[model samples]
Target: MTRTTSALVVESAGAEPQLALVTLDSLRVNGVLVEMYVTGVCHTDLGCMEGYLPVQFPNVFGHEGAGVVLETGNGVTDL
Candidate 1:
């Protein structure tokens, strides 16, 4: 089953970030589900958000975060 979560989303280039409900697909093989405690929008992310970099929009805002691993899918052993 999939889960619903809240995230800061950018709908298009130069658009303001907004809080939205997003879906999480079932964990795939070797996938890890993290529950983020703190997330950040770094310069690289800002570049992508500002249209300075080529990226697809309707995108979630963050690549940097600290969190606990809630679930580990099959084939994961090094965590």
Candidate 2:
């Protein structure tokens, strides 16, 4: 089943970040779902928010993070 959660989203260039309700699809084949407890805001995330990166808006930021594995999809053997 799909799940909904709060996420930091960039809706437009040069706009402030906003908290948005996002829908997450169920785990796919060989996919894993992580419940992030701690996340870091880095230079890249700042760049993306400042339009320095050629990234699409309404995108989720913060690649540097640590989280627990909440679910694993089919054929996923490694944790």
Candidate 3:
């Protein structure tokens, strides 16, 4: 099943961040799906949005976050 979620995406340099809808198809063998409760945007995110940092467009920022594990993929033993 495909899972859909909303995220803050930087579409381009010098552009405002956008609320984007994203879809997840499957997880890696050792990956776990997370349901984020709180997220924080840092200086890196700002730099990326302002073109100071080299990054691909439509990238998801906010590395500082807290979340709960919703599902674990195959071969994942510890939760």
- In terms of TM-score, the best-performing candidate is 1
Writing each residue's lDDT as its tens digit, candidate 1 over 1-79 gives 6989998899998999999999999998899999999998999999999999999989997888999999998878888
Model 1 scores a TM of 0.93
For model 1, what is the error of residue 33's alpha carbon versus the real structure, in angstroms, after optimal superposition? 0.3
| Candidates' C-alpha lDDT | 0.92, 0.88, 0.86
- Position 1, candidate 1: lDDT: 68
Q: Note the residue pairs that clash in candidate 3.
A: none
User: How does model 1 fare in lDDT?
Assistant: 0.92
Q: What digit string (tens of lDDT, one per residue) describes model 2 on residues 1-79? A: 9999998888977788789999999879899999998889898888888998899978888989899998899889877
- lDDT-superior candidate, 1 or 2: 1
The TM-scores, one per candidate, come to 0.93, 0.89, 0.85
Residue 39 displacement in candidate 2 (angstroms)? 0.6
- Full-model lDDT, candidate 3: 0.86
Name model 1 segments beyond 4 Å from true.
none
Candidate 3 similarity to native, TM-score: 0.85
Judged by TM-score relative to the true structure, which candidate is superior, 1 or 2?
1
